[model samples]
Target: MSNTTRSKPNKPDARAKLLDAAFSLIRAKGYCATSVDDLCREAGVTKGAFFHHFKSKEELGVAAANHWSEMTGIFFATAPYHDHQDPLERVLGYLDFRRAILQGEVREFTCLVGTMVQETYDTAPAIRAACEASISGHAAKIEADIAEALARAGMKPDWSAKSLALHSQAVLQGAFILAKANGGAEIAGESIDHLKRYICLLFNRS
Candidate 1:
């Protein structure tokens, strides 16, 4: 007896595939343009599988934002910037890391939640809130380093560390938009360079 038929490989979980699809498609095409059909196609799943995991497209968007946060949280937490003993050095290293990651296409390096929230902020409250949390939470991580640096430098600026942290995100999000408009990452790297310079001036570092 010849046994020639091979067993099929296991497929990824439908929900996880859908999340991965959202990350790619939304960044490439933006949120309002990417429909359920697009996500299902990209994920290699059926419409039924999509609907089974998500009650609505907006619901899926919210989930995607949270998933992005969780994934990037692990990424930034493990980044080598934290290895610096001096807090100012750590902050500058973080900016350097951001600059270094601007490879490939604009869509490949841009933030997923930032792309979604820009389009959905007015229409989808749940998605907007989720995106806000993701951006703010990451900013808070930077704020810790900024605050520590401020203390070490004994510089009591009128502005709060939290405000400066949020401003950094504003610059990054704007840089992504500019990259989309101009079709490259050079502009984004320029913005990061300016940000790093500003941090140095604040910390009185050369």
Candidate 2:
């Protein structure tokens, strides 16, 4: 009798698995280093499945950015930081929450879109645009709180809420890079602490 080999069954959510795998692998190895085969193996799916969902690696990069935005948007929306009645408190709480969540491996905590944009921004316009949208979309979610905080404090700042919101992301992405260089989360936490202090000073809460 001939030996029989059994193939693993396909996951009902293969697309989501691919996105999750891409997010993790890309964060660890970066866009240029990760390949279609890496994603397929990581996702436990075949190249055929991957191509069926995403036309190419570049297409997957764009989808991954959008996936990152959706997953993280839901995460922050349901986070406890929003429970504060005061908008300024909510804003500060959001930063505090960010700090609190920094206990993990660098790849685990770092932003996927941030990593991808740094690598592919010059080479891939579609991926870059998707990353920009993901980052800016997340920023816009907090812009309302920043605007309300500024108004409640009776402060006339030179910067718009959109700019300040973007600034916070800039600080975070920079912190992630520094942490990656330094090989620890302490520097990243300190960066966030400084950001919190800047926010306090801005709002005259310090």
Prediction 2 global C-alpha lDDT: 0.85
lDDT tens per residue, model 1, 1-206? 00111112276688988888888888899998999999999989999999999999999999989988888887788889999999888888999888888888887889988999899899999999999999999999999999998898888999999999999999999999999999999998999899989878877799
TM-score for predicted model 1 compared with the true structure: 0.94
lDDT of 1 at 51: 93
Q: List the residue pairs that clash in candidate 2.
A: none
Off by over 4 Å in 1: 1-11
lDDT of 2 by residue, 1-206 (tens): 00011112365477878887887788789999999999999989999999899999999999988877877877788889899999988988998888877766788888888999999999999999999999999899889999998888888888898998999999999999998999877898899899989988888896
Best by TM-score: 1
- Clashing residue pairs in candidate 1 are none
lDDT of 1 at 54: 97
* Candidate 2: stretches off by over 4 Å: 1-12
